[model samples]
Target: MARSLLPAPDARGPFSPGFWRSPLRGTWFTSVLGVVLLAGVTVLFVTGLLSYAAYNPDLSPVNDKTPDKGILGFYLFSWPTDPPWLYRLTQGVHVTLGLALVPVLLAKLWSVVPRLFTLPPARSLTHALERISLLLLVGGALFEFVTGILNVQLDYVFPGSFYPLHFYGAWVFFGAFLAHAVLKAPVAFRNLRRMREGGEERADGQADELAAPRPDPPTVSRRGALGLVGGGSLLLLATSAGRSFDGPLRQTAVLTPHGGPEPGGGPNGFQINKTAAYAGIRADETGEEAWRLAVTGRSGTVRLSRADLLGLPLHSAALPIACVEGWSTSDQWWRGVRLRDLAALVGHDGPVDVFVESLQRRGAFRHAALRANQVGDPRSLLALSVNGEELTPDHGHPARIIVPAAPGVLNTKWVARLTFGAL
Candidate 1:
């Protein structure tokens, strides 16, 4: 049997490997994993923005009434107004994605660490920037992931507002990532071009000398590896799926028998009434002819009458209405027709944006416009009832918009009219 010889460390740096060392398989694995994890982060960030845009404040009364309870309730504390199913679903996705990122990031760090000691050529300012950007990228990513996980686990126990940190940190993450990509663009392009031309540039020159060219190592058989990855992703998806189904998950934090007397009827009890309100709107004492839902902007001039709306097919959903505020309530049955169906009645073939106007006309209340996608999303609806009862005057008596999985602000209340036009 032949004995294997281990390479000695460099004289200059005790830990440094020879100049022409070979890149390890772990490096390739980490690189691929890092790219995938980065893509996941981008998706999560964009989706979060979309959810924010779709938020409907009208749907969140608790937040409006008790700002502190509302603020702390949804994200951290449990409140009477929190939407049971929706909150859990969003939280699950937020936390699970956060946790999944840990190992991937760790592997990436481990892969690139060896390069730090080698001190590769930094031929220009751009090269130096690229190196620095890589470090920042790693640091920012680690910071975001670690803080995010801790925030979720600790339920955001920081002294100040975690929102400021999370929100501002996102910009930093975005900037660092953008800088890193820009810095690496030229080299990446060149590397791609080289590969296309059958020219290889090994990270370590010794790859050619020490290791004979062999068929690429099967990182698990393709099908088997894909199965494993798919299985893991599916498991995550499954964990969140329960929230969408009608079960205990569908319940909200609001106490049952809403109108029933409580220890304190003021803030602790269910303050919003559901049925009487919807009935009043249907009666239209304000005059049915006067009621108009105006469509403005790109879709051209169009108006919907009361009859036109009622004529459309009605669909009811017991979906939870989660606010960014901490409190949650569940099983507040929503009875309404889908917004998409209503839009279609107006002959909307594609996307349409519209602003919602309320009758109240005071306080934090304000009009908001919905982009085409938000208005068209299947989960968006014009609610007529709450918990199988008609809406109460205090809770958008006439009509309200309910956007599942969105924050409270986006859900417009007392939807007197919808003006479709530029804001």
Candidate 2:
């Protein structure tokens, strides 16, 4: 009986309930969430780059004041559109994802608070540098999140232009992210390997060992406070996201006629006159015979002389020209005819793509091709006049292809020739 004594079973790893109670668990969760949050920021950054490349007025000085249209523009402004249900739903997801990050960031900060007491793993000159790097990263991340949220509210905190802050801050953030990654790479890799080899139990034990020792009486108070703060922040963010989903406030601008002497009627009412420019050509005066449109590519080569096009049925309509830069203007317009109709005149079959060339050929000549379905869209017009008057030279006078709801670049002003090809 005296020799029957035995030892008790071994205790569970550091990641057990006992271990998670320590401050280390909070730091771990925060670190993981930080990575996830950075991923979201990356997505927003890439989208901004694409928008800039697309000559988004919001980021461009040339047409920054112009009105914007198209799907990408709408997404940038977070505006509701014709597809009400679909728009709101997608926008809600975007806003919610953005806003949800706020609490996650806060929780991460809270978790990292206890790390101040503990010594960093590195003690060399390199380690000292790494510590400084981490501090800078934390500060930059905080600034990015704060400014980003303010941007969502349309509150421009920095003076001068929003572009400088948005664009320059991006590079700084990227540098910090890279530094953080380099510093944490080895530890992260080690932890991953240990987890993979030891399974859940070993991982849990490791977490427990890393956590701070709990004071007697089970110090659960901090956890409760964190839960409350995180919940409240999330709720606030969700409420804001809900409101944005309701749709943007509409503010209509008064219409003004900018051509020569205004027509007999006032701005409120207008009409389209076909005698004006169409396809950058007037009916009576024949331009250089050399000014023929050469259609090439998928439909084979077909040249349509100005006379040949004029013989086709001429149609005109007044439609709104909305630019992606947030400017909108309506024109009681005379256009050559429907683009789809013109395509038919040249025997344009299903597979043809369209590109319009301008006489000036200044700057970058805009080019776009429409899918078979997009060609027949009611809003597509080759405009000739605005408000019963000829278009001003600056406004793509003579003739411009106006695709309503498309970006201004795709509108193709001062069109002199047309070409068809595969997209």
* Candidates' C-alpha lDDT: 0.51, 0.49
Per-model clash counts, in order, read 33, 16
Off by over 4 Å in 1: 1-15, 18-27, 55-99, 118-128, 183-241, 244-332, 335-405, 408-423
Cand. 2 Cα-lDDT: 0.49
TM-score of 1: 0.46
lDDT of 1 by residue, 196-313 (tens): 4764445434343222133354556423543455566556444433332233442321222221232222221233322334323444533466666564444465666656666667
By lDDT, who's the top model here?
A: 1
Candidate 2 residues lying further than 4 Å off, grouped into runs, are 1-27, 54-96, 114-122, 185-210, 213-237, 243-423
Model 2 lDDT tens row, 269-371: 3222211343334433334365455555544666666566556666766555432222233434555667776676567755445666666534333444444
Q: Residue 187 of candidate 1: its Cα lDDT? A: 46
True-structure lDDT of candidate 1: 0.51
